[model samples]
Target: MRIPLYALLLCSVPFMVHAQSETDSVHHSYTLSTVNYTIAGQRYQKNYTRSRELQQSTDRLLERIPGVTMIRRGNFAMEPTLRGLSAAQINMTIDGMQLFGACTDRMDPISSYVEPNNMERIQLGFSPNGEQHNASVGGGLNFSLKQAQTGAAKVWSGLAGAGYETNASATQTIAALQYSRSRFAISANGVWRRAGNYTAGKGQEINFSQYNKWNLGLSAVYLLKPNQQLRVDYLQDEGYNIGYPALTMDVSFAKAKIGSASYIYTPTGMKLKSWESKVYYNYIDHAMDDTKRPAWQVPIHMDMPGTSQTMGLYSRAKWYYTNHFLEAQFTAYSNRLHAEMTMYPKNAAEMFMLTLPDVQRTVYGIDLKDKIYLGQDWTLSPSLTVNYVQSDIYTELGKETLSSLFTGSLDRKNLIWNAGLNAEKHINGRWTLFGQLSRGARSASAQELYAFYLFNRMDNFDYIGNKDLKQETSVNASLGMSYHQHRLHIQPQLFVYRFSNYIVGQRKQGYSTMTIGASGVKQYVNIPDALLYGGELYATYRPWDKWYIQSTNSISIGQDNAGNALPLIPPFKSINRIEYTPSKYGFYAESISQSRQDRVSTAVYGERASAGFTIFNVGAGRNFAIGKNTLNVHAAVYNILDKQYYEHLDILKLYRPGRNLALNLSLTF
Candidate 1:
């Protein structure tokens, strides 16, 4: 691989230095942050939370972000929704690459598959327009994997940690070994974890209670001198457990196989000031079973096996002028999926096996964007992308496969497009404003096209797939305002999103005569209209150097064309924190509360609501010298109040397990 000159500059910047610049500068500009956007005219500052010493999972920690409302946690998976959209609607990625869960129940979403300790930073890009990814119909989120840092020759580093909470108890061991030479670098991380079943605040016995997870990743980078490099990464996750809220079956076992290689090239002497190119590949294989579904006389298979693979070619170019920067990207991808199950014959009591032939798709896209500093205190950013996709499906039932080759795929020929504009303007030294507007579309997925059984994880009812579904289109607009003074900092954002041909899961018309296939399959249909509006407010005050107070709140409203409330809309939530950070010690305590909301309208389960409750958390940590070595330790308490309550989105709420206590400790050398 020939390395390009611009690649050297991007790979050379220090992570910590980039953070400092993003945090210290206070302009109405969106150029400072990597993934966060200024909403409705407000620039929100991002803070890094170290997970090595944290006692909770990444999905739980995501709830602490300014806009996250709730998290649906499972044994091997956790789905977090911002303002109320998750799972298939969200594009979850690891290290800039897309990863999909295998089980129909989504037992292994990318978030739960990757350990929190392994991540260096988490950036929540809530772009309702789906500008960053083609599949994010609801919104887009980006998770940045922590890269190895070997600034010093003898940078020996590793960490050991364990945590225990009333319902969730876990212990983990991890180590990072790195070797960097003048032209080559090697880094590896290995981790193992085990967790017991967790209960809710009021003593609910949520089900399938145990899980174990292990992950190992190795990276080798060969620097082909100045501007070129080749890197390879191997990451794997294996685990098993019970009581998934969204699924009818508990996953007995699951594993993720991921292998990626990227070659970057930058010529020291290129036509532009900086230019870089990259190529990458990814794949996943999964298998799991449900112990109770077969016994329940349902039409679904007791055992399921599924697999998918994706290959992508990515390239980007950037040109920096005196006061403006222009960048463009071109990407092409190919993916495929397969699933199988067993169903019993209606009258014979004999079971037969069935397999979905295979679903394959190819996608290509081009994006162009620009950022201009109109003035020292003002910034403008505009971006647009156009895409084309193609797909083919095959089904096998009676020894022979049923294959369909269509000249024009569902939405393959339709133009998937996006356009957005973001601007930041300074009001004064103490105030700033930022706003953005965008329009985007999402093409249908393989699951939506070929799935024939029930999505027991999303709901207990059977789900029928729709091969004729169309692409979903949406438009969003937001504005924000921020106040920054010597003693106070506050940021608030408000936004609205409108959808056309939105895909929604609701009960369909028609009944099945065969009592065995499934109770009745729920049809996937496109709703004529859907709309969502929301806002988030966050603030911090530092009356004293060592003592500070912070608060954050998020709220949203959603409805269908008929003015009926949408399902799973998270309630209004707020959290306040009081912290003391002295010269040598750190301590913090916080209380979180959410208002009760019974406004549900999924049609299947009508008008179900959750009760309001409050919980408290406290933590303390210190760093000191221990004979020639440094020592760090910390601990925290969760659900200090042990309040009993059920979450509206919790699939386990049907079992009523509530309240939990947890503590965590970590040490690094």
Candidate 2:
């Protein structure tokens, strides 16, 4: 892994150097639409500082973004879907570093490893032109870590906060500290949270809806020279006794460690604007069991453990020229995953099998992007990425276990690539039109190719892997118009995806299930084709001074070649919010509603129709200053009507939380 990373780094050195040219003013223009959630500065303090967002998890914050939804199994680690696409379809990264989860059941997503307090901002891309780092169909999401601030008048700064919630009897605590010097800066932060079983609407307790977790982060930056800098970051996250009400088993423990080092160079008088290189490593360990279940409910005692490790590096450079902006990157990474299940049946020895076989995967990729300013009215941006992927089953036992079901070699390799073109026409200062077209491909994941009897609680079926599955490819296109005026802004966009060799689980007859009481057995297979289309509309208006109103609406539709609806597609959803701020105090009201979803893939995916529901929330907050210190207090009431509801994408149609009152307090100096 180290050797390959070094080789890539050496190969990227030439791209960082160019003929020197006089520096000019930088022009920041984008052809593709992007949403940036700022976590620092005045915008963050004005919006999120007055609400429960300061105390909420990263996943909770993500739910508020348009075109993004969560698949909730429990209160912790909800999986995020971008434009109705999830898992291997989208790419998620932290600070440009690739990370993979260790849980075979996807109980721990990458978002769960970072606390909101340690983040600077979140960048969301909705087009392939924006996802230049990876070949993905849905898009890309990057979580930028907060770095220590240097050159502040005050050399030291810190904050401490705490929060409480009524429905789940949950408590949260957080603290952060930073020190800055003329050329050096360092920051540290930590967060801890604990929650008990939560009650649904009508005061009905939801069993096993509890969790406990803690996260710690450290970051440092040093200036080697006026134009050179070095930065380092480390993060540690751990969770214990996390309950999942919709799944058969609960997580006993899950932990992750991530670290990265980076170097950045900015020259004063050259065409090369900046160059950045980074090396990163991460490891995760997860274990789950049914020990918390009642004896009558447990048909068999089982324990599952999984581990994943990754090491990677990337070099990126940006160059500016007359009427053109160019960017290039080289990335390489190696990842290993291993998972096993041990089942104990009555009057029999324990049966053991590899769920996610010991699999090693390596990838090398290059990306190039260029933006051209055409005649001041139109902007054209084109990008291309190519990746070489190789995967193999390492352990002989894993190979032999798959040999019983498959008849060929267990090694697989593929060359994947993505190309995209974006165009933007500025009709006027208040109106703009943008469009994107892209084609992308991705290889199958380890679980989709080599897993042994992985149980899916959603359909109550045991899933087997197929080693001969073909790569999935898609052609995507989108068009949108943005309108902005004095007090009102609205944007509406529509997108479509046509996929070939779509991968899905198909029921297999005459195959016995390894999980006790499973409905049947299913295997991963490739279908001929599939289609997915969606649209979103976002609007914001300011009626008067210190008052604002916002609305967002989204809808998605999906079908297979046979015209059968795809499973897990979300229904039409809408969110509306109103806010008022006066001096040091703020108040807000929000409404969230979803339409009924009757499109069920009953026979193939075991999906059921979901009913429509609506919910409301209100919050108020105030800020106080004393000497050099500041204090903030906030209170919110969620599900004001105590309505019982579940989203269409929720697993098992689990009921959401009931009415709850939350209080938060924070102190900064």
Candidate 3:
């Protein structure tokens, strides 16, 4: 029986209550949450203290956006599910551009490539299909890079910081430098992270060791015309890594090189009030090395290389009239992927093996949206979008036939659609209500159709893709209320999702071959029936000018035909934070709690019951001025009591790691 991830969280609630306490009082210069929205009517933001040592990436930053929940798998990249639709259903874009992650495990999302500190803001549309960005389908995330002062001349700035965490034996460092001149700007940022083996709650030392990574990026922007600009960027990451709880070989030496250039044009006068056009291209080359040991008399090491190239163009036209605001956009995108594998055969009769597959794909989309004000504090928004995709895939088994299995190439086409409507009303002087309904559909990605590989991290299992997978469709609706008082801001939202052709995993009969227990082969299959419902409460209160507190609670329930809770449907969770700022310094304490859940899905190996525990975090920082320099220093301690707990989404739970203390320090000029 599969155990639900949430059940463990619920069980930990009792412990959570005991770990929280009130700390010192100070005044904060400004709350990061309040700085996000310029227009207060329809925006929400959450902030993670710099002392938390959250991963520096766009995807991690999305967690600060209201109405979004991030289900993390590891330090790698998080998978986002908006209103019960995730993966390809969620549109992820960076700096107005889209790129595909090359990892077959979806380990490296485009968001993972962007450093969080490099971003000015991350925005999300609560209603799926409300707006279109490039080839986005269900929901859209926009990553905006930080910009220098509007008219500053020859400005220079930089920041440096480092953090250490006991859990997962993690340590990291970050630094950034920037320069801005009239009509020109340049910036560079980088991060280095490393961790040793970690011991779980059971006192088992998981092999999660020696995971070292480094990434560096450089960007430049130039204004060619008053209304036009050009930007170019380059990024690279090199690392040697290992995933805990892996039954076989650890992954090592992964590397990537990326580059992109974009031209953006905005004309002040046109048929529409304004029009903006953009085009960009990016390339990624990835490779990894692993040594398989299970089921073999001796170690079998191998190497693999994968590459992806992408190009895209998008444009938007905006029109404004007396009571109506309208906008339309079109996008074109294409990508190509190539991969090769090299290995050693154990038997003298057998020779080295290799598998290669080449894939190419293209997509086109058009979308339209309108907002109308009907008086009486009433407003309405409607949107529609359509998209199409085509792909060609081919594969070659170097040895002609390793297991005498038959395979064939595939060529397919797909069409997708989305529509949504939103209505809002101001009920009173301090309260407002809103409702939204949206329907979205997305076609399967190329990796879902043709991928076939051994995922050693999950227990030396082979994952096979199915070509017959169907498009997934979902309808979502939400009702919410917002309140603003002199010292508080609050929003509560409830939502439900009805799905058709939802995709899930199913075990295949007779395909059960494993070195461990009776682990059958599970493949992605389409489910015709599915439903999900949930609600969230979020608020920020400033009881006094010197103290601020924020709280958020969320719960979601999902089920299939049997009406059993879906496995890993994030259990009820809450986050509370109290912060105090003193002129140029800040101090904060935060607690996150999870309720235990018991939902389980198909049989999975090493799947066991999970328990919960509460973690305490406290930190303080201050900025000081030297004669000619500005410097800042901060420090924090995580898992204050050194609690032993399990993260529902932590893929290393099989080893049961415990939390450890962490510290951070920073300098800025």
Candidate 4:
């Protein structure tokens, strides 16, 4: 989800997927959102105080966008979901580099590592047609980090910030510095965060929610010539003592290091307009155990550790001639993963270790796009992508216990292609129409094909991966329109999707299983023929100066060909907002309501129905000057009425947080 913020403190704006041109003669700053922006309407930018600490996880940011939601289990690492799809169903990236999570229990989601402080902008694509990343059923997210500002004159700039929250006793500190001169610039930023257990609305103390985190980043850019540039970036993220009450274990520690370098050239007075080449490396190490949580009465001492490494290269170029624009991209990436589990019994007898064989996946892809302008009010854009993916297992336990339980070879390969076509037209200056159609495909993930007996407490099921799973393909379509004029902005969209070979976990008997919960075992398998449909509506009205009213509503339904509802589908929901803004300060009130979800899918191993809930929130912020420095102060209250409710998407349906107060302060020099 992406929001625009420049200087305004009030006015309603939607989070969006970004689309921009490659030509130097074109400049676009707005995003594609639920409520489209118009030349005659007002635009507002969003601001988050204490961005470095990220009061909650990144889920809090994505939730504000239409068609986006999160799966909350604990206070940390809330998993993001889009239109009822999550995990491997979506493409997750940072600065165009893919990063896979290392936890079988999902203690770490890709979004947990990057906070607003390190983010300059986000390019979000809700389409499942590999428009930006690769084939996916839900969508794609790309987080671009902040770069050193450039200018002709030498300059120095920096910021210092600190914040505290009352409910959880959370504290945040952050600092950043930058220097630019002529064609060269360098910048760096660091952040630290710590928190204790938080209380529910009824003052119920929740365990396993405390955590500490550290983040650091640096970047440098140099101009090679008038239209050529070189850039480098590095970031490190660390977490200690993170907790997850919904899962059986807590994360003792997790760390990630990411590095990238790119060269860009944009030429004028030529047929070719822009070209870019980039290479990157990322590594993640994660360890989890029950030692960090309250000691269980059981006698077994168990620990699990996992690691993932990724290396990739990406190249793209765009060309412009008359009314036609063309762009092409090529990429090659490889991912390696290793995991092992250890156990020690109080009786100190017959302790054993089972390690997953090494897993490696390599992918090569190419994409081409063409945009043609017809007359002045109509535009047509078409794109196509082809991918070849292969995964090979190394050190396959030859004739060992692993070979007896799982069937099929560990080597898998698939060739896939995706296509998309979009059309847009301006009926008049105040109204515009757009439509899109696409077909996309995604292959089974390595973990889905090879992980052994991973514990899942949510459904009380032990999961085993099958190497024979097939690919997933989706046919998708959507139509959207906008009414923008004067002080009102309204945008509405409708969409539908049909899938073949949908991947899901299936209950199976007579399989080696973990002796916990119901002890039921399952395998990742492919289901045929599934359908999903949905729509969203958003509107904002500004009747007077410094005041606005905004409202949004959305709903989606999913089911298999047998008419059985699918699991993890979101319910009908709406969000309403009222804001008042004046020069140095602003105030707002918000309410979110969700209808009960009764259409549960029993086809899922242990699915359950979900209840409805409503929440209220209020916030305000101000800017002031102290000596020669400028300072901004912000404060907010959540769950103002202290209502106890839970979202259906929550992994454990845990009660949501109670009434809470938060304060943030930032100083600039």
Give each model a TM-score.
0.86, 0.93, 0.83, 0.92
* Cα lDDT tens digits for candidate 4, 81-176: 767877787888988887888887777888888866676655556676533576676667776788876673438877888878887898888888
RMSD of 4: 5.2
Worst 10 residues of 2 by lDDT: 7-16
Q: Model 2 lDDT vs. the true structure?
A: 0.80
Against the true structure, what is every candidate's RMSD? 5.8, 6.8, 7.7, 5.2
What local distance difference test score does each model get? 0.60, 0.80, 0.59, 0.73
- Model 1 lDDT, residue 214, Cα: 76
Query: Backbone clash tally for model 1?
Result: 37
Q: How well does candidate 4 score on lDDT at residue 281?
A: 88
Which parts of model 2 are misplaced by more than 4 Å?
A: 1-52
Summing lDDT over every window of 10 consecutive residues in candidate 3, give the lowest-scoring window: 20-29
TM-score of 3: 0.83
Best candidate according to TM-score: 2
Residues 1-669 of candidate 3 have per-residue lDDT tens digits of 110110001111111111110110000011111233211253333332342232333443455433455555444445565544456767767666667766555555666665555554455554456422633334666555544332354388777788777766688888878888778888887888888777654455655344677888777888888677787777777666644233333455556565656665666655356666666666666555555334452244456666777787777778777788888888787877665556554563433333325666788888887878788677787888888877665344422422233255466688877887877777776787877788878777665655554352432355455667888787888887778777777878888877788776665676754223425456667878688888877677879866777777777788876564554566677777787875766777878676765665534433334455566667676666775555556566655665666545444444333555556666666
Query: How would you encode candidate 2's per-residue C-alpha lDDT over 91-175 as one tens digit per residue?
Result: 8888888889999889998889887777765666666545426777677777778787767677998889999999999999999
Off by over 4 Å in 1: 1-55, 70-76, 128-131, 150-155, 166-168, 202-204, 265-276, 292-301, 344-357, 394-412, 456-459, 513-519, 602-607, 652-663
lDDT of 3: 0.59
